[model samples]
Target: MALLEVRDLVVSYGKIRAVKGISFDVEEGQIVCLIGTNGAGKTTTLRTLSGLIRPAKGSISFDGTALTSVPAHKIVSLGMAHSPEGRRIFPRMTVEENLRLGAYSRRDKETDDDLRKVFDLFPVLAERRSQPAGTFSGGEQQMLAMGRAMMSRPRLLLLDEPSMGLSPLMMKKIMSTVADLRAGGTTILLVEQNAQAALKLADVGYVLEVGKIVLSGTGPELLTSDEVRKAYLGED
Candidate 1:
């Protein structure tokens, strides 16, 4: 069975529906990317999976547990972590402080080991461990956001627009970290508008438009597909 399964998921903002019955799965040890334009429900889908937003109609199963009814805080304890869009870090807080909050759901308050692991993943974060998050560059802040989420020691890591607002060099660093995480056994569900980069790194790819999946395929397959090439890759 897939590590994370989302079936017929629908989400709404009052009268307007943001997600209309989309479904996908993330297998263990693979990177599955959902690539789309802005406002295509990619962020909304990740938010719902994180329990920050409830699905109006659908089911989310993570590691064999039904997550639709689970609260946001509780969802973190179930081995799923969301590094949301916008790199929502606690600016005033120290980098360590921000990362520690991610482990709040864990029964064990001892997070030293996890902290070390996250630092290893992002050495710059380790260098600025005591600095206020607000003082860092956008790329640095993004690293902290992903590291903070990692403090939860999740089985399934949900990444939303991780390459957003980053330089080519910075974006490459972040993407490389993603591959490292996968190599270390973290199943990832990624949402990105940078289709070329995301699709190149992904094991599987899904194309979303207006809250619905328009296509699905392996990374190489979708990269070569005419539809994805035109719509997302900016190729004629």
Candidate 2:
């Protein structure tokens, strides 16, 4: 069974439907990416999967359990962790403190080991362990967000717009880290606005347009697709 499965998912804000019956799946240990332009409901989809927003319609299942009604905090204990868009780190909290908060649902004794692993992933986080999260650069904050999510030891990782507002070098660094996480056996469902970067790092890619999935394929296939090229890849 797929580690994560979303079927006919629909969501709305008040009267406006932001997601309209989208279905997708992420197999265990695979990197599945949702790539789209702004307003395509990419963030909304991630938010829904993470239990931040209740879907107006459709079902979300993770590892054979229904998640549509699960509370956001409860979802973390189910082994799904979300690094939301905008890197919402607590401004006043120290880096280590912010990371500790991510493990709030856990009762495991290996938290220190996990912390070491996260520090290994982003060495700068270790250097700034006592610094306020808000004092870091944008890329540093993004790393902290991902690190915080990893502290949960999640079976499925949800990343939304990890490369948003980053420089070219920082973008490359973040994408590389994502690849490493997948290689290390974390199933990831990524939502990204950088279509090229997302598709390249993904094993499978879906193109979401205006809250609907218009195309789905392997990473390389979508990267070379003529329609995708014109519409998202900035090529004529």
List the candidates' TM-scores in order.
Answer: 0.98, 0.98
Candidate 2 per-residue lDDT over residues 162-218, each given as its tens digit: 999999999999999999998898999999888999999889999999999999999
TM-score of 1: 0.98
Query: For model 2, what is the alpha-carbon lDDT of residue 163?
Result: 94
All candidates' lDDT scores? 0.93, 0.94
lDDT of 1: 0.93
lDDT tens digits by residue: candidate 1, 1-236: 88988899999999989999998999999999999998999999999999999889999998899999899998888889999899999999999999999898888856999999998989998998999999999999999999988999989899999999999999999999999999998889998999999999999999999999999999999999999989998999
- How many residue pairs clash per model? 0, 0
Q: Give per-residue lDDT, candidate 2, residue 218.
A: 97
Report the number of the highest-TM-score candidate.
2
Worst 10 residues of 1 by lDDT: 101-110
